[model samples]
Target: MMTTVVWLRRDLRLIDNPALYHAARRGPVIPLYILDEQEDMGGASCWWLHHSLRALQGQFQSFDCPLILRRGDALSILQELIRDSGADALYWNRLYEPRTIQRDREVKTTLQAEGLEVKTFNSSLLNEPWEVQTGQGGPYKVFTPYWRQAGGQITAKQTLPVRDLGSQDRETASDDLRDWALLPAKPDWSGGLAWRWTPGEKGALDRFDRFLEQRLQLYADKRDFPAVGAISGLSPHLHFGEISVRDIWNRLGHFEDVAGVETSVAKFRSELGWREFSSHLLYHFPEIPEKPFRSQFSVFPWQEDEALLTRWQQGRTGYPFVDAGMRELWQTGFMHNRVRMVVASFLTKNLLIPWQKGAEWFRDTLVDADLASNSASWQWVAGCGADAAPYFRIFNPVTQGQKFDPQGKYIRKWVPELRDLDGDEIHTPWKVAKERTGNYPDPVVDLSVSRERALAAYKSIK
Candidate 1:
């Protein structure tokens, strides 16, 4: 039997995994995971990965096959694995990140030159970034036109089932999961993450199912309200490829014709489209992760204050809404999308901090801190990305809190210091009497002053 080595990266799930499925059909499959040192994984991402791999490891073990774990240079390890197992073929799903793309291409070329049938598949995205194009046959800078074409092109690709491994058991030297040190140690800051998330395929499926059963109907109406639990909460799972985008897209097809679901389904799918758009933006413009997509914003005057940035990061921005979002992220490895915008705006505009600094902080803190999505989102909020919000459209943290988090439910949940205040006082604790405002810090920067500063900075670049 021809042994084919399957290199696993972000696509950790067994279902609908193209590379794994095709490799299994060919012959005996040796599943291998390499910890490429070049890849930059955040702390929360590492926490999720640790649990996700543990779950996948159990699934593979059920087939009596070892999910080989090795760390170091991917090319060197693949060459060594090929030699050891006498594998004549290499298979892997494509990753769109800039560094991974270059690395995978080089690996494919080198291995193919050595007479290996190396193949790659698109298991991560519903469509490859290049598949959808404008009429001019160029990439899209705007989302509405992009999703209009891209969404129509989507098909209901059937998810593959877990097939019999056919006695394909291979024993290889594997690195212990604990040795990876993916979880925090001395500080052990992941207590909340452990309580909040279940990082695996089963977890992903369960969340999606719950979203469909309960939240789907109200999703369009209440999705923007931070206090309402109407979100799918599948972002981290999607980022990790614990669930296939195709699978989600396929499942949504069943709800297309259902009454009252059309609007919600469209809204949800557009979110998926946004994920695709972010990837599309990153692939066509690789520098987006590091530099502004809109070049004119390159010279935008941005404040350099670590003290201010740290306050924003630690959820002590003195803006209740922004602080709540930050605190929620720290506690749960996630945040409400509405709050995300408010907090991001407070960072880049209200505080006059650079968007890159906020992006870096999120990339380190968020479980779903994808390179493309994180960078794109920060840029969008900072008015420096393709089709980004206008510079003058600043999010007043107090007004945002009043609008999305009415009654202060979301804020009170995260910002305990402001829990005692009622009415609009919760949104602006500084306005309340000092006795009522506990130890919550004063407004770090006056909102009015910062808004004008941000505008002036944008004018400088313009």
Candidate 2:
């Protein structure tokens, strides 16, 4: 019987995993996970990865298959595994990140030359990044047109998890999970993350099921409110590929016939489409992660103030809404989407800081820190990306807080310093008595002055 080694990366789960499914059918399957330095993650992401691997390791135990853990160069590791395990075939899912794409290509070529059967499949995206193209057969730069084309091609196509894995009892040498040190040690700042998240395949499925049953109908109307529990909260799971997008897409169809759910379902699906669009943008424009998509903005004036950036990151920007979002991210490793926009806008425009700085901070702090989404979103807010928001469209943090978080429930929960303030004052505690506001600092920058500065900077480039 043929022996196939299944290399796992972002696709951590077994359900609807194409590479694992196909490899299981052929013969005995060996599951492998390698921690290549090229794909390093932040503190929060590492914490989640540790638990995710532990959960997956337990699942594979049922089939008596050890999830081989190794760290170092992926090519050398794979070659060593092939030679040692006597495995004749290798199977894995595709990752679209620029560095991973190059690494996978090298691994595939070298293994194929050595006469080992190497195969890869897409297990994350509903559509491959290149599959959806414009009328001229080029990549899409705008989202609405892109989704209009891409959304049409999606179907309720589903793949099942491997149900029949032939036993492989060989005790191959494997690195201990503790050696990876993916979890924090000295400081151990992941207490809040533990309270907020359950990072595994079962957790992802449970969250989705809850959304479908109770919150799907309210998603469109209530998703903007930071305090509301209307979101699917599947982003971190999706980033780690704990659940398949195809499965989520197919499951949403089950509620299509339910009355008054059309708008909510469509809204929720489009958010997924945005996730696809981010991948599409990154694949086509690999330089976007490091540079501006709109070349004219390359020379745009941006201040380099470490103190200001630190204030923003610490949620001490003095704008209650922006501070609330930042604090929430620090505490939970996630932020509400609407508040993300407002905070991003404030950093890029109001604070005159570079968007790249904001992106880097988010990458380090967010559990769902995806390169594509982080890069694309920062650029969009900075007015330097494909189909970006206009430069003059500055988001007033005070008004944004008042509008989205009307009762200040979201703000109070995250920014407790101002929790005692009255209804209207919660969004702008600087307006109330200084003693009552406690240590909540005053506005870091005069919004009026900074707005003009940002506009002048844009004018210089234009």
Candidate 3:
């Protein structure tokens, strides 16, 4: 029987995985995962990776195939693996990160040159970034048009059911995953993460099923409330490709006649669209991660206050909602979507901290730290990206907390210091009597003054 090698990356699942599925069609397959160091992979993501890979290894074992783990240059590993296993063909799902795209292209060229049939399939996105375009034959800079055009071209359809990669006799050695040092060892910071998520294909499906059955109906109404927790919590799963967009899309169902269900489903689909738009933005404008998409913001003044930044990072920013969000991110490796925007606004607008710095912090801390989404989102909140939020629409932390976490459940859960404050005092502890206030820090910056300062700064750039 022919031997084929399947390279795994973000696409980690057995079900709905195009690469492993197609490879199984031809003959016996070897599954391999390479820890590519060149990518901007961060610690929490690395922590997630270790567990997810461990889960995936179990998945492959159930199929009677072993997953080979390697750490180093992917091309070098692939070449060595091919020679070692006598594998004549290789398959993998595609990655859209700019550097990854470049690396994969070069690897594909070399593999084809060596007479090894290399096939790559799209398993991550609803539509490949390149497939969608505007009327001007250029990439879309605006989200609505991009979504409309792209949405029309793609359908929620999954391919044939999985046929496992049957056992192969060839023995291939793989590096021990523990030796890679991907997880935190001394002073382990991942205990909270362990509590929050299960790491592989099974986990992704479990989370999706839980959301679809219980939460999808009320998602539209409840998602904005930080206390209610209507989120699918699937970002890291989507980023790692433990589940495919199409699979989730199809599972949400066509629900055409159902009123409330349709609204919630549509909202969720739009979120998926935003994710697609982020990838599309990254594809068309490669510099989005490094530079402002709107060039005028290059000269915009940003604060260089390390002390304040430390406060922000440590979730002592003196604003309950922002602090709660930051603390939640630090402890759980995730944050609520609405609160994320509030924190981003607080950093970039109110404090005048650079968006890049906040983005980097999120990258290191968040399990769902996707470069495309993180970078685009930071820019979006900073009002310096394509179709970005208006600069003057600064979020007042006090009002935001009062509005979303009206009962203070979310704030109390994450920021424990302010737990006893009752009513609106939880949102603005400084407003209450000094004796009633515990040790919660004072407001970092006066809201009105900061708003004026931010607006004036924006005007200078304009």
**Candidate of highest lDDT:** 2
Instruction: For candidate 2, give the lDDT of residue 82.
Output: 86
lDDT of 3 by residue, 78-100 (tens): 99999988999999999887898
Give lDDT tens digits, candidate 1, residues 1-462.
Answer: 888899999999999999989988888788899988778888999999999999999999988777989999999999998998888999999999888999999999999999999999999887899999999999999999999999888877778987655455456778898899989999999999999899999999999999999999999899999888999999999998999899898898899889999899999999998999999999999998889989998888777999998899999988889998999999888989998999899988988888888888898889999998998899999999988999899999988888888899998999987888996789888888988878899989998998998898888888
Which ranges in model 3 have alpha carbons more than 4 Å from their true place?
Answer: 254-256
Clashes of each: 0, 0, 0
Better of 2 and 3 by TM-score: 2
Q: Estimate each model's TM-score.
A: 0.98, 0.99, 0.98
Report model 2's TM-score to 2 decimal places.
0.99
Q: Which stretches of candidate 2 lie over 4 Å from their true place?
A: none
**Full-model lDDT for every candidate:** 0.90, 0.92, 0.90
Give me the overall lDDT of model 1.
0.90
Deviation in Å, model 1, residue 161 alpha carbon: 1.5
Deviation in angstroms for 456 in model 1?
1.6
